[model samples]
Target: MIALERPDDPEAFFEHAAALLAEGIAPEHVSWSGGESADLFAAATRAPRAKWRGEKLFAAALLHRAENRFSLVYRALWRAARAKGWLGNPADPDLCALRKLEGEVRRDSHKMRALVRFREIRDAEGERFIAWYEPSHFTLRANADFFAHRFANMRWSIVTPDLSAHYDGEVRFAPGGSRRDVPAEDARDEDWRTYYAAIFNPARLNLAAMQSHLPKKFWRNLPEARVIPTLARAAQNRAEAMIAAPPTAPRFSRASAPQTEAAATDLADLRAQLACCEKCPLHREATQVVCGAGPLNAQLMIVAEQPGDHEDLAGSPLIGPAGKIFDEALRRTGCDREKIYVTNAVKHFKFTLKGKRRIHAKPGAGEIDACSSWLHREIEIVRPKVIVAMGATALRGLTGQILAVRESRGKMFDLAEDRRLLTTTHPAYLLRLQDEQEKRLAWRAFLSDLAQAHAMAQA
Candidate 1:
């Protein structure tokens, strides 16, 4: 094997790799070392250079914390030289490895930037800031410019175990040192630590989540980490105390007081009242009021758009071709249609007479607003744990917001009385799609949204 030695960084690795590639040396024949072994290719030395794009890729991939990262990068470079757009092909093993490394390095660099805390130190040059951090990757040199740009007005120094960066006006690097090199205590550290401790809510304590972000490896450098154990030990007691205290009055308790009695009254009487409703002009042309059907104590409530031609004649909701798609989706999600409450945003069909047939028409904002009263009353009666709002009109009816189906599909929003509203495309919308592939994809997505609602309802 052709043994080679270079600096322990991406730039150095790329430079050496580029030189070796120019020399027509294959990756399989090469045995690389990052300052650990003597160079056997001393006689094969040449000027090291790479393309701009290649250099950029190396810069990002170098930040990875993998042990054999250099070898993987070299393999990727070897393939890249032979084929154009090699990196774009994710099926390539080398390219995939490089991309994975890039992601890890990017996260590592972000954490280093967020977690670093500066301490004030006095020297011959007056006041200066110093911070010590330990990163998972060799990202100190790559991230040094961030500190220089952020603290351009102040003189600062950041020391890591593998590297050190100092910035007065310009950034410069020096050899890495030990934790003893940094001051253990600072005057302002206690004040910030006390402030953080005071604001920490014990009731919201999630130890696993907290540890995932601010890991145990980084705890030694953080001032707030000193009290983590004490706070964690007392979290249960503090949370119990908070729960034992009397509940505070809601913000709109008085404003919503009068409606509570009305909400508790009979729902059948409410449906009877809706039969003669003329709040909107849609009630005039429709055959009859299509009230919601299903179990009274259903955990899942599916709200669809306005009634179609078949549904309008049948005096029911979700009974046409679109209903077939919905039933299939419900079956795929293991949800029983008989056990779930089904309703429409508008009780009337709102369709245009096309020759002898009635063609479906979209409900107007005024119609949806007028119909919300009945929808809200159904919610108060059924009291579903999860409400699935299919299509834009259904969402507008429930939430008073006309967001696009693509924007809010499969996302849950909090409604009044602890009910969650999940937005998704209507089964009717699926039937209207022209492309077979797109229709199939949309059908799958619709089923996925139904599954989410099913899971939420069960929970």
Candidate 2:
């Protein structure tokens, strides 16, 4: 058996060694080293010896014999190198340390990808910047272009134990060095904290998700880390407050119309009337006024803001892509589609035609107000046990205010006569997000709200 170590041309040496191995030469019979040229000899002569560039003979030795008795091999190699005067003096410990550090760095590269947290920063010159970091490896220099292209207009830097790399807004991969502390002017701690606080939705608090994306190891360095615990506590408090708060006052004064004694009979008649009625300007633009549809005595009623273009054309509520997503959500939540009525707050399809496409236009407050009478009529007739508001516009028409959808979603509120109302995200919002992970998260929140509503209805 032969063991050969060539520091340079390791690949060619390995190929030759393999051919020799095929010719029945044993690996234990060979041993050689040639300073910086040792790798080349090893590459040409050794049978599958690990090859490393530059003066990484120590690391290569470790890597080559790692599966075997690597520690013993390393010690033997060290002793041999010292006896032969190949080893440097003790004054330059960096040479040995760097080699070992490089090996450790190679082993832990994957962890850096999982732990780095990037925060957007801005300089006094109004230049955008981002700061990120990893524990030890110089992976940032190798991968800086990925982030620079992602945020091309931003000046950013990644700090690591070995080095720091910076991007100057246009070009990437400018070298930088580690600093003991970030400059006061460059530190965007407060701004990052504020932005994180403002954007985080308390209603959709998921500790696991948060921790997965921004690991706890990085929390100490993040400005938003200070608020995480507080934010979580506040979210819990807000949830409890929602459960304790009294129902909002009814938006419109109840008219003195004759109270129908039988809900079942009134609901039947109202359903019939909705199929034929020409109430607002919507009926003029659309073919027919579409009404809510489900079991006559459904426990839950889902209310969207208005009919979409497809829904308007089809003369039915919730028959488009958003509706399909809503249906899937209902199935996942175990909500009985047969027992859940679906309708819109406004029965119109408002749009602006762009070329061949009809872009959806948000319904105005006045339009919503005009349509509220019909929504009120539906509520009176259906007399559902619970209502699910699926968007801001739907919530506005139902609750009669511009409420914070992010804050209010998933909580049950009292409608008139002890009926419950649950607010949640619109499917359209989920559709607009380009990121698959964020979309999945939003979808989960949407499902959670629906599940809560379903559970409440069952209760």
Candidate 3:
């Protein structure tokens, strides 16, 4: 080992040592020992060495031995040098190398934290212990104290390139190669395979996001890596199958069993009963009771806010101006109206008379509450696979006021069982906008929402 004494300035020491290092002389082959005069001696000798002013020192000797050849000695001297702050400055290349080693140690510790899969293993003495790790660098001796404190009671060993650390109910670091004969008590590879398969969610698979988080390097060690390609292919196939599959048939919830059964039993009875319902006084001024119309087994259920003036007299759904817009939107979406059940949240018509004209009045909360029972019954009996909630009133009737209608309009929420509720603005709302530009924007939004709902239903 070479020794040289240099001045306090780190640059002088680095310059002297760098020149020597650049020469054929190895760091260990030179030595310098001096004080304030040490800088001049270092410049003269150009030796990498320990700077000393009597017992005090500013820098330690540098060695040019390979990592595998002198790892143990290098590590011991490195620790002593660090404790004495002999490196003068943090930016010194030798000091920088030491810091890089420190960083690598910390990175190894984190990797052990993330990837070590402890499996119970018994030694030749029949002592039980857990063992699972694969560290790529020489960090065992560098960070032995950490693992010693972490796994004190268990018998464990972490094998790395330079050394193997063992804790036999106590912590110990030994310099040697690892033995491959030790038997692992648990089959880690198989268990990981099972765990990997069970946790993969097919419903919410995002390939790009998944690949970003789990890069290919880590995948080589994971058992699930083998199945990733297959799983992705299966997901694509399933999505295509969904597109080809017919729309889901309506399903009645168990809660609506009695009402649904009644609705299914006699349509005439339900219509006759609703015609006399004075749940709200809207029926008195309205032309007639407009009931839901469509095939009983329809897969899609369209719930509008209320019956329009034309619909009230016609006693059918989608017969007014807004209804005309709805029909056009549906035609554009390629939806078959015959396959959908159309209904209203409010069964009774609420209107105010202005001369001979009757203007549509929004149903109050009370009317909505009173009429929800019939809608719930209709939902139960029809068991439509998907429910399209048009307008705030219809959405409020179905899902309550927990979520804002505008923010939640385009998303699908699982209501009960496999049933999904898709919310959108009513065509009437689009019609009411006086600004042509605003009307066009609103119509576009409405159409986009409907298109999304149609896709979701199909999915």
Candidate 4:
């Protein structure tokens, strides 16, 4: 049997595996030599090497924090390299095991972040902070960067059984440390416990949920845990007291905008107020409210559904991928983009997170309705001769009714104040077309609608 050497280091492990594969070594021919899983100063990575880093599943599997991670990863990688349905089958046992390992590793990292409590200390140089924790896995080095970024100005050290990390402007990982190496408590710990008790709502207390999040194993080290038993014993009386207590004014209320509030004097004034508008929950998640751009006196107004990811960050409308297509089409039709007022029905971007990327999710009817007031005020100010609504969401935001853009495209309808409204497929729809002929036909139809709108504005 060919026993593995230097199995702790990722690069060395991959190199060994690569050489064995090149020698046509079979899986059963190899035997596992499971030693301590990290090499300290020499090389301490428990992840896949450079060549296999691109395979997300394999790389994540290598971070399992289990003693058998190396052997399990090699078996999984071997099956994958041999095309043994490891990559294709979602229910593959190896893949399923890797997913569970990755999830537990991630959970351990999150708990370490939440539970680490730093206390002030004095050294030969100056004041610094030190904290000690007994983490489930080797996460002290992995999470050192998070502490460095969060408390960049202050020096700190986090000690665990597996390793210890010190940050004096830069991060350095050292050998493991014991709880005696750090201070047990600081003067400010009492203040934190008081604040924790103040925020603990007895009415919302769920013991199972609380225990799940703050496990009994961690309670000994946590200062706030001292008050938990006392609080639980008195929870019933506290809840009753809360119910009998007289009602007080709210901490905040958006709907309570005073009736005596001053009205906006002009477009600029209205826009400045929109920037601070928290009338709906959408504003809380978005970067900022994006108001319309272009000449207020312009005869043509182009309205899209809402600001996309690009527009949200840039704090402007008609600047993303869809905007590029719309701008090119308008220029082709002999219409200057700057001459036309550009905006969205909803001023905030609505999206869901996909890794680091934000994927656009369609806004709901209520969200559109919440922002309808802003759209109506914009229309009142611009008083455009022709208004173009790009999609169903845009049409609904404008008129407060679900109108079919497919049925209404290219047909003009009279709006209030003798204004003309037209509907068309959103520029984003063109990018989703799979068939060449269908894309060409749709592009032609889109150009025709824009040309017709420009013609109506000119007339």
Candidate 5:
């Protein structure tokens, strides 16, 4: 075995690994030398290195706290050089192990960044800040630039057992020192403790979550950590006190009645309210509230999912490409588009932008729920004999239960007060089917469902 002494740093390891690869040294034949023993083989020849420093995973794996990391990383690199695209195969055991090590190094770096507590210290030259931190991994050097960016104008020094970093206008590194070298107490510490206590909100206190973010291991250096236990003990009483506190008067008055009472009282009032509705985020970008357009007392009510891009701009439902398909289906089924009430489950068009064109995005459950009030108001006002619900969103709004279109189609279910609802495929679904045969079949099914709804309305 060509035993070699491994250095305790990434850049050094990079150079060492590159030399081994150049000399054509097999990974298994190499053993790490430490203490008294050393390599007696000819010096490793220089070769073109694998771009390990430029690769984030390789760089982070080198910083892992494990003792065997040096050999493991060397082995991985050796295999990667021989086997094409081995590093990219995440399913490989070696890559998985390497990823775990990288995660540990990153987590350690994050902890060091979060828990480092600085204290004000004045030397003969000027005011500066010093922090003493104990990180499990060799991450002080890796995280030094973070502090530089966060506190660019200030002079600061972070001293760990393995390394130390200092920054004024520029960053510099020095040899590590003991925690005893750092001053434990500072004048600003008391003020920090006061601030920590003042900002602690009892109402939002989550002990498990707090412990997860602020581990007990870091409490030794944090000034506010001393009071954490006391605050936790008193949290229940404090929260109760907050809950029992006298109700404050409204800072700004809204129309006193609830949305259900006010908005649902009349269809005209609901439409006016919906135009300015901020109930969900969908309204923020939508052109206008595309309310239902049809005769007031139409026998059949047709509810589509929501407005499409064209319908959004034109301020009408079922006027886009999907609308054209629906019109074709209506013509085939002998159903008059003007005689029936046509609206959407949601009033606004929800979409994501792809280049200049807007791609339709399915509305989430929260958005659907928020818009249900308007739908309910529409139903109350129109009071149609039969409702044809196109797509899952429409079915959900009318029935308040998720029903599959394929399973529920061609059948009518009672929807209270002698009214009925028929679930069917949306015209947009027909438009998405690329196969001409499948499109033909789906359109026939849709027309059949619409014809059934029309027949039910007449009955």
Candidate 6:
């Protein structure tokens, strides 16, 4: 057995693991600190350097958190060097554990950035800001540059249990200390509290969600910690007052909202009526009305749940990440997208604002019912021989009944006017999966559904 000194940090572990690999030491035969003593290759290494194929950053982050990181990383390095495509395999037990470590490290880093509160202090350097944080992992150094770039004009120092990072014009790391090292408060905290109160929206109060993001562990460090309870308690009253005083701007709907349905003769005319649809309240918040795109006389009609962020802005359906997945599936199945018509169940994009980003909100039952007319008209105009409903939302829109997509996928149901409806998993569903094997299985199932639909359309 080869005895090696254990690496303490991520960088040291990376270097040691690489050197061990270069010396051609098998992972099982090498011992970092303690292991059973009986190996065939007894001493100095003779094997040539195995070429590394795996990402170093991937191993580095996990090494900082895992309990048996030395063994785990060395085994990963050994397989990654000799075996082709070993790095891409998520089915490996070590890779699965590494992924979990990556998530925890990522969350810890985000919390370090968000919850670290700095207090102004005076010393020989005039005035400087100092903050103390206790992270779950060794994330203090990783997030140091974020603070440096965000508050470049000010001199700040962050001290954690493991290490300390200081930034004047350049960043420097030092030894860490306890929470008592940082001061309690600064005059700027009052300003922070005032700004938090000004932007607090009482109407959208979700206490559970707030607690999930700003957990109990971070409450003591926050300037607005005491004010959160006060604001939450008075949210109902404040929301009522805001509703009564909201004459600043009338919702910008057309003076004469279109009297949807029966006025449309063709696809173009139906789209014109759909533009000013006020039948649903979702129209009030959306950017613009998105409608179907493709040939009017196509034999196959594809229906998705609704427009995403990109589709909302561009006024076209399936034009973002979901679109790329769908395009690839079409290519695999030998189906031409241009020959098929595509549209959504709901014309408007429904989302909630997070900072400046609009997160996609699932359409409720009432919203789906309101938009059913536009889809009804679309079906009448196009009159495709076969309709493929991607996901349960599209399925519900067609039948007006809630049915599980998984239970009914790849099965054909006869519809009115000599048309057929086929159920399938959405391209968006495939995007949510993290495991490589699961993604591959889901892709195959999705492709099979599309291929079946295409064949039925041709027949």
Where is model 4 poorest over a 10-residue stretch in terms of lDDT?
249-258
Among all windows of ten consecutive residues in candidate 3, which has the lowest summed lDDT? Answer: 56-65
Candidate 4 residue lDDT tens string, 1-459: 323343224555566566655556566655544344333333332322234333434544454557666666777767777886657888988678877877777788899899888889999989989988987765565677898999999989888876788999999977878989988889978987998899988888889999887789888778888898888888889999988986331121223222213456668987998988877788988999999998988999999999999999999997899989998898889999889999898889899999999999899998888887777778778879998999988888776678777778888877754688888999999988999999999999999999999999999
TM-scores, one per candidate: 0.51, 0.44, 0.43, 0.54, 0.54, 0.49
Candidate 1 vs candidate 3: which has greater TM-score?
1
Residue 362 in model 5: shift from native, Å? 14
* Local distance difference test, each candidate: 0.80, 0.65, 0.65, 0.78, 0.80, 0.80
Tens digits of lDDT, candidate 2, 162-196: 45667675444434444343432335677777988
- Residues 1-459 of candidate 3 have per-residue lDDT tens digits of 322232212334444444443444543544443221222343443244433322222222222112321222233344444466555567765556655555554565566666655555656866554443455443444456777787776667765434566777666655555335334435666777678777766667898898665556556545557788877778767767766876442333557432422353445667777888787778777878888999888778999999978888889987899999999999988887877889998986788888988888889888887777677777777877788999888876775453456766776777787688888889988877899999888888888877877776677
Q: Candidate 5 regions off by >4 Å?
A: 1-8, 31-57, 88-91, 198-213, 239-250, 253-312, 315-352, 355-459
lDDT of 6 by residue, 67-139 (tens): 5656776787788778988979989998877777777778878888888889999889788999988787778
**Candidate 5 local Cα displacement, residue 236, angstroms:** 3.3
TM-score of 1: 0.51
Kindly report which residue pairs in candidate 1 clash with one another.
Answer: none
**Model 1 Cα lDDT, one tens digit per residue, 1-459:** 323343446655666776778878777766655545545564543445553344545567755656566677777777778888876887877777777888888888999998898888888999999999999887888888888888899999999887789998999989888788888879878876898789989999999999887789998888878888998899999999998986332121113322322443556876787788888999899988888998999999999988888888898899999999899898888999999999998989898888998989899999998888778778878889999999889888886665777867877777755778888999988888999999999988998899999999999
Please list the residue runs of candidate 3 whose C-alpha ends up more than 4 Å from where it truly belongs after superposition: 1-266
Q: Looking at model 1, which ten-residue stretch has the lowest summed lDDT? A: 249-258
lDDT assessment of candidate 6: 0.80
User: 236-338, model 5: which lDDT tens digit per residue?
Assistant: 8999998898633112112321236475566677678888888899989999989998988899999999999999999989999999999988898889998
